[model samples]
Target: MPDAMKILLFLLTICLGSIIMQPSVAQTVVNKPSAATADTVTVRGRVTDAQTKQGLPGVTVLVKGTALGVSTDTNGFYKLVVPSIRAVLTFNSVGYATVERKLDAKATGARVVNVALHPDTKALQEVVVTGGSPSQALMGSVSGVQSQAAHDRKQKRGGVSVQIQGISSMPRAPWYGRSESYATIQENSFHTARKEPLSTFSIDVDAASYSNVRRFLNDGQRPPRDAVRIEEMINYFTYDYPQPAANEPFSVTTELATCPWNPKHQLLQVGLQGKKVETSNLPAANLVFLVDVSGSMSGPDRLPLVQSALRLLVKVLRPQDRVSLVVYAGAAGVVLEPTPGTRRADILDAIDRLQAGGSTAGGEGLRLAYSTARKYFNKEGNNRVILATDGDFNVGEQSDAAMERLITEERESGVFLTVLGVGEGNLQDKKMELLADKGNGNYAYLDNLDEARRVLVRQFGGTLFTIAKDVKLQLEFNPARVQQYRLIGYENRALADEDFNNDRKDAGELGAGHTVTALYEIVPVGAPPVVDPLKYQANPAVAPASATADVMTVKLRYKEPQGSTSRLLERALRGTATPIVQASENLRFAAAVAQFGMLLRQSDYRGSATFETTAKLAEGARGKDAEGYRAEFVRLVKTAEAARRPTEDPESYGVR
Candidate 1:
């Protein structure tokens, strides 16, 4: 709390580069997208790995809603048209950066978009947007990745390969989390199409992965890859990314490494830290923790986790921080109001008074909490509403539309929202994501105490202080050097290529020290096209770039707190060699995780990803595999592969 202490903390953090620092500014944000400028041409391309050159299958290619799209073939190449579309495409894959590709569309008829998907050594996950179920997305002019027509055309060249994999994890019946089949159109076990013809392709994660993670969450059994599902990873556990004092290790720092279930596996080490407040810091705080103390949250891993996690948070609060506790059950009411953070005993008492019963009045609780937050309005402090729940808001204004409106309106008052998700069964993950995005806040899942510490106590800066908002990435391909590119993941967040610099567009969030990952698969230029090409755009080069296309630049825009306008920051993509060392711990861990995500999804692009390959990859780059994340990854691979055949075979994942 003192100046000297703060300076000492900064010095220490400088020494430990990974120690997320306390923000320089006192920032409680009502986040928004950065500004946008027109008059730029929208250039698009696909991204694929440099290795296989396949369309890193199941990648996401969106340009915000302007009907512009880019998807790669089995060979990874994308196509799109746009004007002044600054950084048109945001290429994302699990464990890779949510990269923005901006290029000159003309001088290059077909640009070669090649990017090597990095591994996330820090276990960070790239955000995923799951739309209103594919069954409902029937009317848009979508890029066909799974349509029968597209399949037919491809089938004309290849064969259909379909396989439905199931698992038996429960040791009992029902086999609840068993199937990994996502409606693939396969022929004689060879090649085929994804279910949703027009929309994005869905990769069925290996059911065994889900079961493994589930076992960990439900029983702390520590199954392989048992701690995944970004939503759950962020929600189920609470990691304290507490405010770093003047001299304390910024926020709390924790790391772990352990040998996996695999006898040949080495170890997994995990490293974590809190956030740094960069500029214009504030002091007095007003936090409203809106918890769903409903019957639904009474599970072993649900309400209990919330209680324990919140208690930890209470421990980290400074005396200046204020807290409010609101519970939503049969009805919503404030259990505690504007209590000083220093009143630890009293706050814990209030938390203890919570009991699960009655129906959930999520709407009423939300409104009451918002009112209370605004009532004590700490214009100079953090004014936020943290919601903890299993998401079964069956009472009051339970409709999705109503909740969305409530959150959106609350966001207008600069009262940011943070949703802490818990437990399975009736989980409204999609709804939670929408609320967080609309409310200009972030979301996480709390599966256990360690997770709580990791999020709340350990890495608080990235969770709370938002640096660049509405950061949209578009990469223009130099067709002269590349042939095609396909973006990985982020299928639901795709934007119309032209929407790249559109100020009005809403985009993704970036937390302090938080790393986002995405991967692209690309084909080099001069490679013969697998399909016939139409001689369009003759004399493609009409004019030279307007001085902007020297190197692909990452364009970012964000509104200042309480300001109607937005500012911009542009960074040109430079440096030829990928800094394997300076790369954040997020890269390696995330890369491994992405590979795991792909394997679970049973992607066709994953050639030779036998158990041995997965184990070796995880074993090789398992950065700080803390809490055994890498070890767990290896275990899951083995479990999945063994689940395929009986006596511990390495070729299947629940085929038995």
Candidate 2:
């Protein structure tokens, strides 16, 4: 057997064995609970829908006035550790009236709080009443306006909406549909070094696109072509770049290797590693959570998910940090004042009590959130607003241009933004990205609890703290060594060549410990060009490139978070291309991701790329695989492959 296959099989065996042993470990009996105390109690129950008498899953059962809570499983079963028997348990779920039950576990040796919740008329009205289909019913229950808005957006963009399988328990609806919005992408064509020597663009630290793609793949659907941003997909995983030393905000690394899918082309990788600062050493934070309580957010995966996700972020807060809550529905208002991080319970309770209803006043919400942040703005602290929503903005400053202006004006106050998107169907992805881009912040999409933890907890510093802003990269290739080059991705982040040195031109922000990677597919000196050799070009190409042995000169410009002016750094790429197998794990893995994205989008330039090839490349480059992110990525790739597989019956393609 081949060595690589043998190693893969060995790893598979170890992983499967571990999975098999988990149940046994879980089944191990525990010592008898310490004598039941008056202060502590265990409560178990099953909740159901009052009308259907069917079990309700994902219902939040919380100890009233406290942060303690647990969600019911698929079987509507729940077990919670209550701090006291005198506490009241509150059951909350979208479209249902809140239910509260006072429990005294001591009085009843084994207390059971089985309750059925009734639907709220207002929430029910949010659903469009159409000929009943399981998918229609489920989707309708979420937001009528959202569906309409999606339809309008799709129609406006000269695209058609597509019907997708509803969540579990919903029958497919012929009329039910979902719409995705992405900024149109115009692939960068190869540029001859002699004709166009410099390639410049802004940096992108957002990984929302990757997680959003995962959500689609996990749901057994292929992501829309526009939704696949290759740059974001590659940046989602961290690269092993050297940390910046003294007097530098970041370090730069470069690698050249043969392209995996197209061996004829050479790949160049440029990576920037932001300086890492311990969370404790970072400045105190003044955070304002701007939550969307619009009717569209009324779903198990929307408001409830946001609440749960924010709790994880709260757990990481230091005592020096302060958080405020601002919720928007019909209007925006502050729910909680600036509360110290030490009072975590208070912050969590405020988050928990947020119920979804009413129209979305996104503009008003932004105004209020910025006002709140400004009121508590600490010059030395990390002041920012975190907007959690489905990106559905209906009321007030609704146009993309208007929203952009609002965010732009607000960012001048030195406060950053963090847009966390949740839910689907009518996701305003473009609007959210625009807001984040203009607000001088980052954007992330939360598809599930795991993603929530990955963003809000594991990458807390990078997601929240901005170390540098307006970062841009400009690469000048040597015509003597290179013929043509094309950037692999970052279509939407492209900037004018002059913008590289213009500090007034806004760009992207870099957070502490964050790393950004960009790739270029280069055609060496004699390679064919995409454009016809201009017969007698306006300025005949002159290749007097110096004998410095440099392939390209890289210039980076960025401003300190608080500085108005930018600083410049330069590096040069020199030497022949490295073999793929001998390339650094970071380069190989990122190349694999870019290949996967191109294949997913069915890009014409993805020469000979296949999912199988991408997966194999990634498997070999899964360095350390800490936190199992790379492993999860492998599983996601396989899931996408399965989803894209052709069935035996051609008619059954893309059908459940």
Q: How high is each candidate's TM-score?
A: 0.56, 0.74
lDDT of 2 by residue, 1-656 (tens): 99999999999999999888775633553433434333677789998767545566556676665434666665568887776777887776544567789986458455778988875422211222334333323222121112233334334544322221112332211111465567888777788888799999999999999988876665455677778899999999999999997899899999899888878778999999999989999999999999999999877568766876887798899999999999999999999999999998788657756778899999999999999999999999899999999989999999899999999999999999999999887888999999999999999998765577678877888999999999999999988878889998899999999898898899999999999999999887655555677667584654535545799999999999989999999999888888899999999999999988998888988998888888889989988754546765765675576563312332344223
Off by over 4 Å in 2: 1-176, 536-548, 644-656
Model 1: CA > 4 A from native: 1-275, 278-284, 527-532, 535-551, 574-589, 624-628, 643-656
- Evaluated at residue 293, the lDDT of candidate 1 is 81
| TM-score, cand. 2 | 0.74
Q: For residue 510, what is the lDDT in candidate 2? A: 97
Question: Residue 642 deviation, candidate 1, in Å?
Answer: 3.7
Which one wins on lDDT? 2
lDDT of 1 at 398: 68
